[model samples]
Target: MTLPRLFAIAILSLTPGLTAHAGGKKGENSGISFHLQGDPSDNPKMIFEQNTAGKQVVYRRNPDFMTKDVAAFNSFPSQDGQGFGVVLQLKPSAKNRLAALTSANIDRWMLAMVNGRKVDAVIIDKQVEDGYLVIWKGIGQAEIDAFDTQVPRIGEKKPRR
Candidate 1:
């Protein structure tokens, strides 16, 4: 079989809900929000957006998870040597919901919007049962500072109420 066809078959086998369309656009906003890819058939519930590539993509209007769901995080130098990479640990409730979302949306793309711009787009290759999401790269130091103010670093003690 052709490579692309084999790839499609593989993805379909892995994710029963897999579809042919997957893409997104940048947006204007502060902080971070992760949006899930939506099929064109979901027009009523989806919105048009532009991905970093300048390609039009359809995605859900509401993020599957957002900054409010973050409990802690860790940042690292990006492998690409361009910017930082952030590893976000979700709150318990968000973690459970993320597990369900990732489990069901395998092979779909998840767009990360930081400070209102499209910073990264990741393919949901597997279920994220641990409730951790990584923005592989394209994160600036300014954004990292913002994240620091919003959520504690992983392993850091939470302040008393």
Candidate 2:
């Protein structure tokens, strides 16, 4: 009946092998939001509006540059070879868009979401060369794994409940 409910239903209808998980405390909203950036009605760019714990969060993706699709995900050591980070391998088409992003867009914020939750608001510092979108700061293995698992789950076909 609410936007969140409608969103959950819509997601359920679209995804395959989706199941309603119970066992949590009753009346608690345990639904997770998983969506890409950008509004399909207005812009094809990466931007998404998500609801988390009854709060509305808007994720604004770069207008000039957006990932076409995630090709793969990998965990690697940081660029300085210290600590660790996640690398998002984007589709080939994303390479063209990445070319438009230069050092000027550095420090600009971009959203990296997982299951409809705002996981990381990454700020770019160097050029997003090639199709590898490296996220080192303000990210952990959990968020990376979520994105890795959930992105491919969009637009799937599940049996009617």
The best candidate in terms of TM-score: 1
- Where model 2 places Cα greater than 4 Å from the true spot, the runs are 1-68, 76-85, 102-104, 137-161
Cα lDDT of model 2 by residue, 1-161, tens digit:
99999999898888744453345433232212213233336453455565533545444443333333555555666656544556666667766556455455565555554333344455466786677665564445565455555444223332111
The CA lDDT of each predicted structure is 0.82, 0.50
Error of 2 at 142 (Å): 7.4
Q: Which 10-residue span in candidate 1 carries the lowest summed lDDT? A: 19-28
Clashing pairs in 2: 33-115, 33-116, 34-116, 37-46, 37-47, 38-46, 38-47
Off by over 4 Å in 1: 1-28, 52-55, 159-161
* Clash count for each candidate, listed in order shown: 6, 7
What is the TM-score of each predicted model, taking all chains together? Answer: 0.75, 0.40
**Which candidate has the highest lDDT of all?**
1
Query: Cα deviation in Å at residue 155, candidate 1?
Result: 0.3
**Model 2 CA lDDT for position 6:** 100
